[model samples]
Target chain A: MPRTSDGRERLIEAGVELFSQRPYGSIGVAELCTRAGVNKGSFYYFFASKEALALAVIDRHWTWQKGVWAGILDGSGSLLDRLRGLFDATAQMQVDAVTGTGWVAGCLFGNLALEVSSQNEPVRLRLQEIFDEQIAMIASRLASAVESGELQSVADVDGAAKAIVAQLEGLVLFAKVFNDPSQLDALWQNSLALLGLAPARA
Target chain B: MPRTSDGRERLIEAGVELFSQRPYGSIGVAELCTRAGVNKGSFYYFFASKEALALAVIDRHWTWQKGVWAGILDGSGSLLDRLRGLFDATAQMQVDAVTGTGWVAGCLFGNLALEVSSQNEPVRLRLQEIFDEQIAMIASRLASAVESGELQSVADVDGAAKAIVAQLEGLVLFAKVFNDPSQLDALWQNSLALLGLAPARA
Candidate 1:
């Protein structure tokens, strides 16, 4: 049996899979242990409690997602193209998920934000920090866009960034509710419009 | 003790309270029974299972919400003013909730759409139907806006309406996450901009 740190890795892997596919409240640690192929005792040996494990899972998931967003947002291209790339990446991920799982698993941060934020204070506070970090990154990119003249100046850049992130999350929720990944199709245009951007030069 | 239909009403009322405050999977029928002041037998008499009761709760919630939306959207006012009225009502309700409970409980439909949409098929389908109804109503109002020349015609009226609803839900999610009711303040402007409307005539 995997012991200690190895057991922790396997448990978090299982958690990301199960939690992303279903609501946090619906999933129990027993299923997580079973899925991870670890015993219940091993599960507790690694984490303090289910909510503790959830906090860990949030950290793990955000690390992976931030890398993905970085690859899209931080890569070489025009700012508009890069932002569009981020939307494309999001849409492609949804497409892949629907192709593989027949369901669009929305963003996990957003999942927890709506589902458990009110019930779990620690998790909600962590999620708030993550959201603030994300909005700041997006605000930096928006500031770059304004500096490069790709977009006009926004009144409140962070506020606009928050709106963009919120809309992206909302579209993902729409995709999940409708079970149609194509619901993400309008993200690039809508996001640009939300930021008051002009049509990007081809 | 409430009997028959009265018991059902009480159970649904309790469901709306608890589920909106917490989550569906975290809430149990026994607790629901306790909250409703009814017995487990009476609860089982109305709902075959907790999920069934959730379905009833969704129905009841939507009926009440649709009335609220109608009062804002269908009542006498300009389309822009009516739209602004909808946002105002939403913010006021969140303010009221935060003041009453110190927690900003987001939209129940939106909460369930994220939490249970993947795990429960019936509830997801019902939510999809409810969202379609909402988007259609918003689209009709958008159409009226185009006819009245309050705004230019949108290429995709339904899509624009969906965007508006998505942003509204997003703002509510932001509110819940930040534990700040002011997060809903941007809905009026963001939504109008989404619909391709000029600054609303003050």
Candidate 2:
């Protein structure tokens, strides 16, 4: 038999899965508890309410994603390599043959941003901050490229960085809806071309 | 004392407002019916079920948007003018005043594409088709520009078109989350620059 702490961890795990799979509002505490294989008492012991559990799940997701990005950006590789690594890693997580079936699940942040952010003020502000941080991180990378003379010095580094991230987000949306990884490939190619990093072909 | 037919339109009107304001799952059928000022029987009479009503609302949204695009594309104007006109129209709809409220209700298809598509096959397929049609329309416009030689001949028209639409969608997502229309302005300017059109000076 699992300990009480194990049950709490299971509840958080189930919440993440459910929130990712469906709209947060659609899933109930009872269903989440059932999925976690824990009783209501255990659920209450771990979190104040379903909303608190959701907040915890979101915090965990943000932390994990930040770690992934940090690992990629901190890698001993070219900037282009770091960008590609980020895309490839995200594509793998989002495009699973078993769960994906015929449809891509899109980015968890992107999905939640669309669904919950408008009505949920806290979530909206948090997502905005997260996006700003992401843009800044990408901008820093682009600035490095500019300093290295890989990219034009006159290039609108901030604008270009924003465009790259925007295009990536768009690619995620298209890939999810179209269920085609090639859309992401095109996005990567076009972005590289825009950045003057794509290899020239005869 | 309104006619029964009025009830149907009323329900749809309420649906558009509520669904666009929040997630589909967050809005209850009972609340929707009350907002429409119609009983459950009238609601059922107009639509088979809640899902059916949602489909109807989606169809209505698609039809209205197609009309807007048609008006923009079919106008007797230069491609640049048309593009600017489209951006201006969108900005007008999205910009908020001192009160900080505007038409930045977000895209219904985008919201649903994120939340419902993964779980609902019917909605997914329908949204997918809508997205494909949107991409096709933009591609056709770019094809015209390519023929006119306004854009570089070597440019990949289809890819450019997809990227433009992707940026627009991403811009909308950002606008919704941040409740700021300035992001759309950046997107519009960057898009025009990408297309080699002179961006309107701020």
Candidate 3:
């Protein structure tokens, strides 16, 4: 079994699992403590309140996603390949994570954004920051493609990047709702086609 | 102001607001009663429990959405025009509803699907049924287009319909996150383009 000596780490792991299962507001401190295998005192010692623990969970997700973006952006390939790689990697990660949990609960950030964006300003702002960062990353990559003369000058880099993000996020939601991996495949092909880069089918 | 004579209508209206603002599990019966301005007895008289109230809310939303679908399906115009009209109408409804609510809460069924799909089988099944109905409606429309030679038979009607539904729901989630209406415009145009329909801008 996996183990953690630090109360903060334990709390975060428990928070991710529970929050992904249900909304953060529905999770109580007692249940969190029990899941983390820590007493209430230890939980309090690590986080001041349930909201704080939820924030830590969001931070953990952000950190992991940033690492994912880094991989996609750093790969030495055509811009379209890199973009397709991002979607493929996301599909694999989602399948692995959901399979391990024995249920497909969808993207945690997307799920939380739907539930709390209107109700909590702090959470909403944080989610926006993450989304903005993602958009900028895609924009930067596309801008580089434009600078290299690989893409048309009138390609509308910002617009294309935003659409790409929207479509990718949209496809993830579809995958979750339908519980089908082929939906992701269809989306992957459509996205690449939108970018004018789908591979020839055999 | 609009008015309802019975307690059940009030409870459902309150539920539409509260449940959309947050997850069903997070909102309590007392809070819903307070928001609806009805007593616990009245709430119970109308519905047996919170879950029953949630089911009622879902049923109401499904009923209302069916009306929207009928408007598009029954319209006399080119298939492309009818599809664009559907998106245009939906966008207007979203803007009007957001202004009336003074907040940017998204679709209640979507919020519920994300929150309860993994943990609650009944809710998941209900959501799946609604989704299936939506796909069927779109597929039937596309079939008409195929008959008229507006779209090629090479097009997978079911796949295209599912993609459109995914785009619409995804667009709503993105719109909520960005707090912008322009995202809906992008979704509207791109989704039509994918369907081989005339672009919304055109």
Candidate 4:
């Protein structure tokens, strides 16, 4: 639904679903074509190869995810509240994957990051930029929180953001490996500790 | 050097090198056989499938790494000193990988965990047990530290250990993606924060 243009959109959509559900190397171009209802010739017409289609899929998913994160990070409530909202939404996505796919699909960028970063330079660079942006997103929020005098200034807001993002990916790994979404329940508290804050009273 | 036999040891060593250098799905039996200098016939005699060899490789790496960790952890100055020793040794491995192999070979279990958790149940379960063991190893250290009053008792020792492991994995992911081991430099400070302590000064 995000990138639907006759054949091209279909290929991207198929890539997203398949790539998220399993390792990128395990999913073949044939299966992607079949799932998209497009033949090999048409698949070639739209994209050069599976890796090309994969790059497109990464862009498409990041586009959608960035928006979702933006909505939550910019939404109502305090900075901590908004951060928790983002974590909740992330955990919910994994939960939904389990409900719909019978397995924890994990974070798409992270799954690809581990699976293809060394093998594919183009994807690896793109993912690096994406991660930088992800850290920046949170870093920007922390800057705002500091400006407003919400609390004491963090010693290094960017470092805090980077640490927080790393924590997110780390816990996501646990969730995927353990096949349990609740593994992410620690994100909110761990994040507060990283920011040098006490856990919020319930 | 570990689990050394005739063809079997060769295959496991090959698995460690190849699997670390590239994505698991991209590597195949033929190449593995070629690298190990073992023919296809003998390869089957040693392991039933590629996944089987992967399991052997996972066990072998953990066995070796467990010793490295136990040595530093059990022989160090204080609990904090031992923990820092472990983190330093972990980072040094990445640096050594870059020096020896020209790429950061990440934690083998983590690489395999994300690459094959959904497709392979055996590896998933084994990785789950390995992660639990890792968390437990740190929790035991924290418990001893608490008993000595070196620090106040952590509110949740297990939870703190889990968070620290998650942080390590997360930063390792960053180091791998960014292709820079310095991404892990924050591990010590961030880890201290996770354990509800301020950063240790020089």
Candidate 5:
């Protein structure tokens, strides 16, 4: 009885919810269909396989996350302020997940990146691209910070960006494992340190 | 028949191998038993469940890893030198795994922390303790580094230790996802930055 196109969207929503909540290997297509209120026929009608649906969920998540990152990173004050804004938002999402779902939904990409990267090549390739973009975004901002005189200069700007992003993923793991968002409180100071800037300025 | 205790060790070995190679949810007791060359009866005799076997595997892995960490960190030259030693060993393990298994076997605790931390309570608690001990070990080293005048002082020794560990975990995630041990090359410089020290000495 649902709209024809609703099936595809619902499948992705279910994929996001289920994948984020548990390991990717544990989630089944039948369960995905049930959660989406789409029958098996409709499920197959949209996605060639569960992997296809997972790729869709991944694309959808990146699209939304990319928008949020662009909005904050683009509309920001100083580079530190904008980066702080991004970290604040990142921490808040974990808090929100705990409040809403009673579980800290860790970084969906990072979670999948670890869970499926070795077993699933398509998923792994997509995740690699996603992480690369994340690093590039931060690297671009750091370059601007140096140009604007907020930073003296960065040696190996891309490496710094990768380190910052790596730190974020690591803290997010702690947040998920410890079930504590405050674990992320160090992001601002640590980000400053990585950039060779004093936190007194932050 | 094999030695009476070999079954237990074999099961734990299989857990380490299979669990690291794929998501935990997809690996079942039967697969573990077959891989260990232990029959079904012997498996239940050794482990109450797959999760139980996983915990045993975790303990064994930590036992070996903690020894390596303590051996490097507890001995050697400056804090920077020891930390570099630890990072090099960590990267080398991934390299070895790639050479032997054609896949990076990321930190077992970290991989499971993200995968089963929410779903399995006992495993979650054990992992929490392991990570806390890891943080504690590094914090103790940083404290000694300060006492010995390696640097002026550390503002938040524990926080810095946690950040360094987090950065390590983040970079490990990259190493696993990107399938490159070189991703961890940032550990030494980034650890210095986190500690409010310069990397020129590193």
Candidate 6:
């Protein structure tokens, strides 16, 4: 069992699990407190509102997510192989999560984006910032790919990066819909096509 | 102004608008009734529960949406051109909605899928059915394209179709994030790559 000294950490963990797996608006402060194993007073002491907790959750998730991105994306390998590895790593993570939780929980950021981007502007902008940062990271890698002769030079590297992000996010949604992580396998291969490259020999 | 006679139609319309624009759990039956200009009694008189009304809204949107699909997808032209037209038409529809409603309302089925698929089984299955139907439609068109020598023969037509659906849904989510419909354009061009085809010369 994990120690629960930090009320803020507990709330953010609970927020990530509950908000990621279920609808955001349906989650109440009481249920969140119960899940976190922290009382309402502790919850109030840590955060101003549920929305505030959500921002903290996003920040925490992004910090971990950025590390994952750097490991697969920023490490040494052919760029295409690295991108493919990222998708495989992502699907495996989802599989491991299903083994633990008994449900297919898609990308937390994406699930939230679809659910509340229109309704919540602050959350929406935060999500957009995260997406933009990810896109820029991807764009930089693609630019590197162009330099290394791995991917063909493209006029719009940023545009291609955005497409890759969209496709990966879309594949994650499909995985949730089918309740099977393997759906991601077939879809992610198409990302190569976005870069004008043939599918890697699998 | 559109004339509103039927209580059920009004409820369904309101459901389509409200649920599509916002999170599912946040919108209550009272607000739905108020938006539809029908009293609570009439709401229950027409439907058994909010989920049932969601089903009606899905059915109604699919009905109207199929017409739009037919207009763009069923017309006589190169199948590739038709596919491109569907994307343009979809983006235009989003633009028109933004002009009219001041929000980038995305695909209603997709919005609901992200919000309720994990929480609601029946709704999830219903959405899965709609997605399967759309995939089949696209697969059939792809089959036609293969027959006409427009597209290379592929082993998994259905899988490719699902990728297109996923990409388009993903692009719409990005559009909502940026509150700009143009995010769709860059991402959607990659759909051609899904079919192993180059972009059509415009």
Better of 2 and 3 by TM-score: 2
What is the per-residue lDDT of model 2 for residues B1-202, given as tens digits with 9 covering 90 to 100?
3448989888888887788777898888899999999988788888887788888788888898898887997687877678767777766666643134443677788888888876777877888889878878877887787788765432666666676778877888888778876777776655654453432121
Candidate 3 lDDT tens digits, B40-155: 87888778889888888989988998998788877998877787788888787778767877565666777777777776667777887888898899889888888888766326
Candidate number with the higher DockQ (1 or 5): 5
Residues A25-115 of candidate 3: C-alpha lDDT, one tens digit per residue = 6789999989988888888777888878888898998898889888888798988788778888877876876678766657788888887
- The C-alpha stretches of model 4 lying farther than 4 A from their native spots are A1-4, A199-202, B1-4, B199-202
Cα shift from native, residue A27, model 6 (Å) = 0.7
The two-chain DockQ for each candidate, comma-separated, is 0.49, 0.44, 0.37, 0.52, 0.55, 0.49
Using DockQ as the measure, the top candidate is: 5
Q: How close is candidate 4 to the true structure, as a TM-score?
A: 0.96
DockQ of 1: 0.49
| Candidate whose lDDT is highest | 4
- Relative to the real complex, the DockQ score for model 2 comes to 0.44
* Candidate 1 displacement at residue A88 in angstroms: 1.1
In candidate 6, residue A5 scores what lDDT?
A: 59
Tens digit per residue, CA lDDT, model 6, B93-165: 8898799888899888888888888889888898888888888888898888878778773556787788788
lDDT of 2 by residue, A59-81 (tens): 78888888998899778778878
The DockQ score of candidate 4 comes to 0.52
- Under CAPRI classification, how is model 6 graded? acceptable
Q: Write candidate 6's Cα lDDT for A1-202 as tens digits.
A: 3334576788899998898888989999999999988888888888889898998899999999999988999777788788888888989988987898877888888889989988888899999999999999889998888887776646578877887788888888877877778878864567766666652111
Q: Which pairs in model 1 have colliding backbones?
A: none
Off by over 4 Å in 6: A1-5, A199-202, B1-5, B153-155, B199-202
Candidate rank order under TM-score = 5, 4, 1, 6, 2, 3
How high is the lDDT of residue A151 in model 6?
69
Which of the two candidates, 4 or 5, achieves a greater lDDT against the reference? 4
Where model 5 places Cα greater than 4 Å from the true spot, the runs are: A1-3, A199-202, B1-3, B199-202
